[model samples]
Target: MAGPMISHSPAAPPRPGPGRRVVLGRRVVLGAALGWGAAGLAGCGAGREPVQRLRLATGPEGGPYNAFGRALAAATQGHAPAVVPLATAASVDNLHRLDDGSVELALAMADTAEDAVRGRNSFGRPLPVAALARIYVNYTHLLAPADGPVRTVADLAGRRVAVGADGSGVQVVARRLLETASLTGGAGRVAEVPLALGESVAALCAGRVDALFWSGGVPTPAVAELARELPLRVLALDGPAGVLRARYGPVYTAAEFPAGVYGLREPVGTVGVGNYLLARTDVPADAVCAVLRTVFDAWRDLLREVTAGARLEPRFAVSTGAVPLHPGATAYYRSVYG
Candidate 1:
């Protein structure tokens, strides 16, 4: 069952465009890998005239959010009215944008969305957010200069680092990783520079920053290409995990970066977290249902971005712990399971 090739950002890789062997998450793709039986969205909206337009918030040009968002927009062309993929800071920024009514639906890391919903950490206060789906796992990438003084997280201390822009999932994860490594700046030695996802790589390459922490799918095009141009190394997060999980919820999972990814000399041990599709709690149930129905109905279309998971089952869709599932999504899941 092949289909049209989706044109994603120019910054990402050129091969295996969407429906290849690219794998993501604890299980895999929510579309075919999960073997979801699509019954169409006809039951989602019922008699409604259909939504007119929708705004989707994704990460910068070279990240997963942007790639998935475009594929999503294409899938929603007729079903969701109109979906517009807008590039933002990713996760934290996307939630804030959704909170402020700038975008109707946004993609975010589960941990960041939990913080926004509970008004903790980088999130200023409690926000009204609901989860539509738990998509894939974003492995934390702690990239450093190959020729620099960094081998482990300890070396990040006293270095100029790019920890994503304000209101971004990268900021949330970077701060937590630093805390996990017990490297929250000794005497304010670590200079944290916040930059947009589109800017982080360039800054590190130009000698503007020592390293940049990123959370995304494997072989993230920008970082993969950057490794070829610059001597880069990934730092392993082999530190205490229980404390961070207890403090930040169960979003973080133990994961490994394969040895060959980004041309690393050896496999880097890191953490993995779930990325989610989030929406406002105020959105109509049927409208939300319609959107998700289209997602699953057209799940195959998202194959390029939401790589097929290996062992995950569609029944695990509602497993997101903190963020409550959107009624529409729940309804669709109910229909799928029941």
Candidate 2:
């Protein structure tokens, strides 16, 4: 049974432009001397302050957050503090871990981070966490088979859908999108299954699920792999994107999956959210400064490993919206701009 053709809005917000290329050149030298250089960061080096082992909460095994986190951990070895990446549900889980003192650093979507700091949605009260940087943009991917009956958001009614794991950012966006489309809760509820990215991909391929919601970078490895095995379509989501923005502030933006992504013949409009690197408010300023310096210094290396065209520019990193910058991060940025 072929699904109805999915058509995207012509006015879909233009795909987010590429990361502005900044020529590091001499700045790299100055930055290293004052910020992340081996000699400059003596506090993190041997024979100075004992190297602090900071637990960084990353996403599930096959996700971008996990990949980026691990790469960062590797980049900081023998230089900055020993960063240890812990695999967990992405975004929401990472923030919760940061709040509970289980993690010193976390990566989270801007929406979930805002909820935590504002005491809305999943969080009971304002959490004491701060942003280290806004690392990249995440595109909300609502995927279904090209041959399946599910075509539009409205078609998800009564369908078995993988809405991400219990403590993940994907679930947060999935529920809201379903509700806005009137396909969730009440009598028309979707059969929501909480599965991690890998499990969700397996479920969809095996016919255990009609569709799945994933919020990550363009060309998510799992989604691309699924496309090769079975024909698929990323549903157009311009309508839901508007509704979400009207309800929330500037957190949600209309974005599109470019043609050739996941084998799509055309672009698909969806939602976009910023991915932020966060830290527990209590983490030492010098430690956070060192980590930020290391990230900025080693960004190109990190970019090569991370997918979805992730960027790590200082200007982009500083645009964390409502999330307050950690004091250490603040110092690092000051050094960069000065």
Candidate 3:
């Protein structure tokens, strides 16, 4: 999978080729499209009932989650249960809100979702959250100045690193990667700083931090803009990918950033994690089904706003791994496959 690198050209997004499953590196896209109309969607346990107002927990401002959330909210302008995007710290924070009934929906990294459901890592207890869909893959980006002293993961030892904002999936993975490189736990520990995507960019440009970690869809707008302002390279984490997967599970996939992204002459290896659309168990099944219809039906319009939006596929959408599917989502998928 490609890391977040903004595209400047008007190149068309990739579509499924001939086969039933089109393999692109570690990800797959279904050739069959879910082009069902309103009548078909109504049969998926909801019978055309309008959905209620729902608040979706999205990431911090200028992040992929927030951008996609706002786009989705706009798509539901005429639909019921108007989806309001709630700007948050992403992943862990979103999950907490879902558990506490602060929000009805969320976008979270699969790794973080797994942790919350299992009551491990960032969560203090098991959360009553379930998957609506495995939305897209998020590439882990370890960014550093192109002409800086740090060239590899090992070089990050004893240096300051912006490990994303508090209660974010970026921080969870960043700290673990540091631990894997033996850059934490002792004298060689990295000086960790928590900052949102925009803040991290500014800090890096001002030399306040040596590196920053971000996990988002390919060509994240903020990251792309940062690249144009300052020359930086995404550090490779191929070796650590295996370690993380071995320790945490298959949530972490070994992937790479393609050449020409961020103007790189070569691909940079990194870890990839699936991003899931989630909802609390208390969310009504009909409402969840309606939201799924909105997401899958309006994907092309969403594509114009976020690249991850273009990745909405039937087969790929159902792969939530350990996170169990919401009943409404189950009904929606059954209708599609049937």
Task: Evaluate all candidate structures by whole-model CA lDDT and list the values in order.
Answer: 0.71, 0.78, 0.80
| Candidate scoring better on TM-score of 2 and 3 | 3
**Which sections of candidate 1 miss by over 4 Å?**
1-47, 303-313
Structural similarity to truth (TM-score) of each candidate: 0.81, 0.84, 0.86
Per residue, candidate 3 scores C-alpha lDDT tens digits across 1-338 of: 44231211123334545544333221211211133344324435645556668999999887888887998899888787689999999998999999989999999999999999899878888899988887777888999999999899989989999999999999999988998999887888899999988999999999999999998866777888889989887899999998998998878888778787877889888998888999998777678877888998876675554553345666667777778777677667655553
Q: Number of clashes in every candidate structure?
A: 9, 0, 4
Residue 338 of model 2 has an lDDT of 41
Supply the TM-score for candidate 3.
0.86
Task: At residue 305, give the lDDT of candidate 1.
Answer: 52
User: Which parts of model 2 are misplaced by more than 4 Å?
Assistant: 1-51
Lowest summed lDDT across 10 adjacent residues in model 3 is found at 24-33
- Tens-place lDDT per residue, model 1, 1-338, is 00100111112222334444322222322342234234322235466666677788987876678878888788877655567899887887898889999998999988888888889877779999888787666777888888888887777778889998877788888888787766785664568899865588999988898889887777677787788998788887645444566777678766677677788667667777777888887776667776776766665566455443312234334556678776666556545543
Q: What TM-score, to 2 decimals, does candidate 1 have?
A: 0.81
